[model samples]
Target: MTEEPVPVTRAVDFGTAKLLPDVDRARAWLLTVDDAPQSYVDLDDPEHLEFEYTRRIAHVLESAFDTPVHAVHLGGGALTLPRRLALTRPGSRQWVVEADRGLAALVAEHLPLSDPDITVHTTDARAWLAAAPDASADVIVADVFHGSRVPAHLTSVEFLREAVRVLRPGGVYVANIADGAPFAFLGSQLGTVRAGFGQSADLCLLAEPGVLRGRRFGNAVLAAARRPLPLDALARSCAGDAFPARVVTGTALAALTRAPVHDATATASPVPPDGAFTVG
Candidate 1:
């Protein structure tokens, strides 16, 4: 496949593997999920490399936690965020949980994550979070996905509770999710996330309400912290420039009051009462 004449936008090699992209200038990406390899089309514009999103993530996280952070990935991609974190904060320790065995095997083939303060583990994200001890992680990134869908179990209410359970004090949870126009899953996800993290649920949508209402294309980063998240500082620190495309949060934060928490043990949860969040 390496000899097939695919454009190589960037390439590298890690301690145990060769890092390369299947194509450059736009191609396809097969993400390994809990089940199998799912496909996505890369517009091939440097603009769409999840790196843009990852960069913003790096910026917010670095500013949020001044020192190097102990990070955990519920899903692993080209390991872009982990790699960038390693470069920006040397000596950080990261654990990436990837479900696809073949995809895990191909890490060194397409990208190298091991050397960059990351340990790749093959497993389901929820199970890992559930079985782990109390407050074991400082920050948990639940960006697990294959194509546009998340594994069925991963989105369930029970799963998110465990995600929150494994986070340490002031630990934050970040999840990358996709939804259809009209944001078919947005409300319910907000509902479920509210149930999981109480008033700490904060959203960073790749698209805005009008766009999400159209539901044609959507991707968002939903973040929750054991403590209050710094949405305003993040907004200010962004220097009034949106990441990737135009995005504004000052108004949205008003509409995103924290939903009430369902019992941590319950599978299906109900949205909690108002006043759960201290609206910004």
Candidate 2:
């Protein structure tokens, strides 16, 4: 009989990091920091994305980009998406910037990525992006968080501008945001992305119906690009997920707007209530 994997815990720079094994899937693990679920990875099945938001992000990439891509990921939690990208898009070059050095090291030692194409940097996401050459990436994925909240610095128009500079023309920028109905932060972020990219960029949001309707605190995946997004394909992909989600754009997106956030006004995303996203 196969041995059951045990949980491993370590004190990282940001918080206590834990790796909890999936009882049903021997090679699968869920990475959590301070009780908030971070990333779920099935080492034996890179195509399997356990988180709804992760699937939504993957849908955007799968729908929009057919060939290999030069991708930059702001958060590197167990390198889940990087592994998926390596499997789905062979020859793709990926760069992952994770701020928590100790957490990065813990993941590296425990998870042990096999893809040589993916390079992990132990540094702040914003600083790394600011230094990146213009038009250096085909896609940028922003999913960084300190514990449960997205850092204030990463939520501003300035940050989006840096993203725009790094992305090649027509490249996509996708972010995983957490909020509920009356999505002030989410709206502001959308506005910031649009304002940063100007009038030419197209944007959309993918989220569950109830979450969009103010049912609960949850994740929302937002996508933007200089070119038109594959909304039809994205809608279908999101709807077919185990927990169905809807894509909002055009008028729906326009209605959910807020003044663009600047560096001076930015703040970390709102904290969740007790028991929210507590790992079982």
Candidate 3:
């Protein structure tokens, strides 16, 4: 038998980045920054989403529209979701903003993206969003993270406004937020997103039942749009996942309360408990 490929490790801008191969899936790689799991991509199968949060994001988009879309990704970790979108929605145009140039280059060298429609930029996500043309993207995905926590500036009302500004009418804004019981950060983020969308939008939170019920620390996906969301279809799609998730809306959603975060007061999300997102 041939020797297994060793993990590729590099010192990226933010931290040490590693691409560990999946023994079961030859072309699959798991990316980690400072020991925190960041992204997993199966080169041979772009449709395969190893992370639950990614699947939830896909559920929101798939349930919302069946046609090609103009998508902006705030975080580009291995370009996993972008690759999936390219396959699922052919002819789709995508822009990915990743802050770490070294990490982006590492991904490019190891896991090159073949789609001519997708472009990758090395810059701050919030800054890129501010400069993006009005109504340019049909979907904006906010999955940026600094190590295991979300950066403060990207969690503010101003950033949310920029995200909304970059989206086309009725477009969706989806973010992968992590929080546990007494979800102060999560609550504040939901409030900030709602405030950004104003009174005309439909907002929903998706997460595993345990996570919602305060049983554990995990990722929660926030999806908001100006138009009515396909809640019924989204609910069905989420419930059918390998790790079934629940969608929160209406009064249950309203019960989660926190002040909208402004740039001055914004803080990075709370640090995860040990091994909360670590992958061996």
TM-score of each model, paired residue for residue:
0.69, 0.98, 0.98
**Between candidates 1 and 3, which one is better according to TM-score?**
3
Candidate 1 backbone collisions, by pair: 26-44, 181-215, 182-215, 260-272
Measured on C-alpha atoms, candidate 3 has an lDDT of: 0.93
lDDT of 1 by residue, 104-166 (tens): 666545443347468888888877777888887788887765433565677666777888788
Please write out the lDDT profile of model 2 over residues 1-280, one tens digit for every residue.
8767899999999999999999888799999999899999998898899999999999999899999999999999999899998988889999999999999999998888878899999999999999999999999999999999999999999999999999998899999999877899998998999999997789999999989999898999999999999999998998899999999998988999888999999999989867768876
* Candidate 3 C-alpha lDDT tens digits along 1-280: 9778679999999999999999899889999999999999999999999999999999998889899999999999999999999988889999999999999999999998889999999999998988889999999999999889899999999999998888899899999999999999999998999999996799999999999999899999999999999999989999899999999998898888588999999999999998799877
What's the lDDT for all of these models? 0.56, 0.93, 0.93
Error of 3 at 68 (Å): 0.7
- Write down the RMSD of all candidates, one decimal each: 9.4, 0.9, 0.9
- Looking at model 1, which ten-residue stretch has the lowest summed lDDT? 9-18
Better of 1 and 2 by TM-score: 2
**Steric clashes per prediction:** 4, 0, 0
